[model samples]
Target: MSSEPTHQNIHTFDQATALQPAGPHHWKGQPGRLYWNMVGPFGGTTAATLLHAVLLHPERIGEPAALTVNYAAPLADLPFVLEARPLRTNRSSQHWLLLMTQVDTEGQTITVASGTAVTALRRGTWAGSELPHPPVTPAENLSPRPPTAGLAWSERYDLRLLDGDLPTAWDGAHADDSLTRLWIQDLPPRPIDFLSLAAMSDMFYPRIWRRRALRTPAGTVSMTVYFHADQAALAAAGSGPLLGEARGQEYRHGFFDQRAQLWSADGTIMTTTHQLVYFRD
Candidate 1:
């Protein structure tokens, strides 16, 4: 473990997702109330925490290339254990397996989440983006989303919606589609980094509620994120709000899938994500 002292001015996000080395390939973390959701801590923070472990690992290699997190169960508002193991290492890529476990009231250790990640040494090469950035009003001209009553995590982000705001009334109205485009950034304004990028990937609200206009029960079951931006690209983004777009592909048998992308102000695709979600009738 690095013996560096913690910065006194650490952001709440870093504090909430903070990890302390416990042993080889193991770390301890606790949920913060600031990122709490209805059932537990925000899924985005949880995902970021998992990635944080790998990022801090002494044996870690390269930057993050892809990450897949599976929410196995709700994590209680208590201390938890995170285990990140480098399963394999290659010249240009590394593979990792992650697990978050907590002790239940019954004294049994159970997994709350699991994940796999790939980090790779990127090489300079010719690259191109096929999808052009969508036309949307600048974030400066739009007002930030009001604080959501009960969901503390909503207050952590400055969201300026360009389309598909949450349903004003739960009248069971059905929209033609569930497409949301918005500009979002950390409320206190932090620099763009891989950890924050990972968290933002799961920031969108459940698509089912937006589609049916009903406050149905829904939560993400699994999420996968592909990192497209390199360190230079992220540095160019700075702390500016990213243009986020998301839409539901299908809803069937009490489940649905959401696809989302994050684009920098300069039109570089920072990350793309897809998630499977479960909803109740």
Candidate 2:
């Protein structure tokens, strides 16, 4: 929506960090919103994750800040290859756009997903204010709690709770306002940047639905991403943690309304996401 620029983001952005490196995890199977619903896919959260990953490092773009992601959505079963390039370089900030789509080969692309991120030129140093960083602890300090005891979506990523007694599989703890803190990171061959975070956010519906005692299993309706600032409080504590938070809501019987707030290591509001989810079961 906005093609404006700002100061450099404190986070790191690298072309190398654009996509998760080689790994066993990837989209491959039934092309349906059902899978997207199961993983909380497409929607606003997906673009937010990808944009955040690239903008984290402002120096790469001559130090620009990321504002938000709009006008696009994610897919459930489409193969995608994300390629980003500098659109133009100005005295203030550098502009960039990332082209995402289903790929048939290293050189072939089909329209699937796409987005744009803008950052400003860094002018000075200042301490910023962040929404109350959740009270959750580091992932390594606690035991790994499973989001779903017997679901395929839950097993895809490396997850750890960051706060108040880990959530249980049968707590009936569904409340639209209750926020859960967790470190969602990718393991193995993947470098695990924002892309991994996007993939992980897709699965949050089940946990929220479970707590609220709601059932969902299909359709990805819509999403919006708003990123304010980046801090270090949400990153890994040592070598095994990547901090982040997701907040969303559910509406009607088949529609899911949601909002997400992502933080940094030193308590910065990395980004915010809004999305609509549809259930299948």
- TM-score for every candidate vs. truth? 0.96, 0.55
**Model 2 segments more than 4 A misplaced:** 1-60, 67-89, 103-110, 123-125, 147-156, 162-178, 188-203, 206-211, 218-240, 249-255, 264-269, 279-281
**TM-score, cand. 2:** 0.55
- Report every candidate's CA lDDT: 0.91, 0.46
Clashing pairs in 1: none
Q: What is the per-residue lDDT of model 1 for residues 210-270, given as tens digits with 9 covering 90 to 100?
A: 9899998999999999999889999999986999999999999989999999999889999
Poorest 10 consecutive residues of model 1 by lDDT? 1-10
RMSD of 2: 10.1
Kindly list the per-residue Cα lDDT of model 2 for residues 167-235, writing each as its tens digit. 444445555464557765443213334443344344344334544553434444544444353233224
Every candidate's CA RMSD: 3.8, 10.1
Give one clash count per candidate, in the order shown. Answer: 0, 39
